[model samples]
Structure formats: C-alpha cells, structure tokens
Target: MTDQVEERVLSIFREKFHKPEVTIDSSFAELGIDSLDTIEALFEIEEEFGISIPDDAARSLNTFREVVAGVEKLLAEQRIANPPAAAGPDAAEEGR
Candidate 1:
C-alpha cells in the first residue's frame, strides 16, 4: 500500500514541480519546493487520495517518504472511522 501510495505521490510531485527525478527520499528543500508549492501539492494529494491531511501532519512532512506515510496514516484513520457494515439479513432488516 505504501509503495503504491509512494508511486502516486511521487508522480504528483514530479508533475507539480516539473522534476522527473523526484524520489521518496527527496527532501522538499532539496527539490526547491516552497511553501506555496507545498500547499498546492497537499491540495492535489488530498484530491487525488480522497483524504484530508491535518495541518500539523502537513507541516511536519519534509520528505516524500513522510508524505507517503502521512497519507497511509490518514487512509487507516478513514477506514477506522467508516468501516464496512456487515452484509446479511440482519443488516438488511436494520436498514429497513
């Protein structure tokens, strides 16, 4: 999951910054990403992943790896918050 997320995110970084060499270990500073770039990238990420990243987490992320980890954490939290309901006659009756 992390690997897939990392690849998607790295793609976003590459497209946003026009840098084809962006890697998971690349620091934002090393990539010459500024505050505005970070905000834009975060917005793009949220839109792409359907998850909201908190300000603290966003601010704390310095590398691509951290961004991937943060996205994974948010996805886990989303799953916990909205787990799938059991499917059976009882669930159908409850819905009715």
Candidate 2:
C-alpha cells in the first residue's frame, strides 16, 4: 500500500515539478520546493488519491518522505473496516 502511494506521489511530483528523478526520501527543502508549490502538490495528491489531508497535517510535511508517510497512514486507516475476505466456500459462509 505504501509503495503504491509512494509511486503515485513521485509521479505527481515529477509532473508538477518537472523532476523525474524524485525519490521517496527526497528532501523538499533541498529540492527548493516553495510553499505554493507544496500546496499545489498537496492538492494534486488529494485529487489523485481521493483523500483530503487536513490543513494541519499538510503543514507538518517537511520532506517528500513525510508526505508519502502521511498519505500511507491515511490510506491504511481508511481501509481498516474493509479488510479483504478469504477465498472459497468457507469465506462465503463466514460472511453470513
């Protein structure tokens, strides 16, 4: 799940910032990403992932890795109530 989110995020950054080599651990500060760009990036991420990151949470993001981590955590919690069921007849019986 984290990997998927990370990949999506990196892709977003590449398109938004025109930097194709961005990695999960890249430092936003070192990369020279400004506040407006960060906000735009967040917006794009929310739209792409179908998630709303609170303003407070968005403010705490300092690095690319943190952003990915935040998204990963949000996605994990969102799936808590929808765990996948096992396969086969026994699984169908358990759902009753």
Count of backbone clashes, every candidate in sequence:
0, 0
- Residue pairs that clash (backbone atoms under 3 angstroms), model 1: none
Q: Write the per-residue lDDT of candidate 1 for residues 1-96, one digit (tens) a residue.
A: 878988999999999889999988899999899878998999999999999988887888889888998899899888777766665556677888
Worst 10 residues of 1 by lDDT: 83-92
Residue ranges of candidate 2 with Cα displaced over 4 Å: 81-96
Supply the TM-score for candidate 1: 0.86
TM-score against native, each model? 0.86, 0.80
Model 1, 15: alpha-carbon shift in Å? Answer: 0.7
lDDT by residue for model 2 over 3-79, one digit each (tens)?
78889999999888999878887878877888889999999999988788999998889888899989987777765
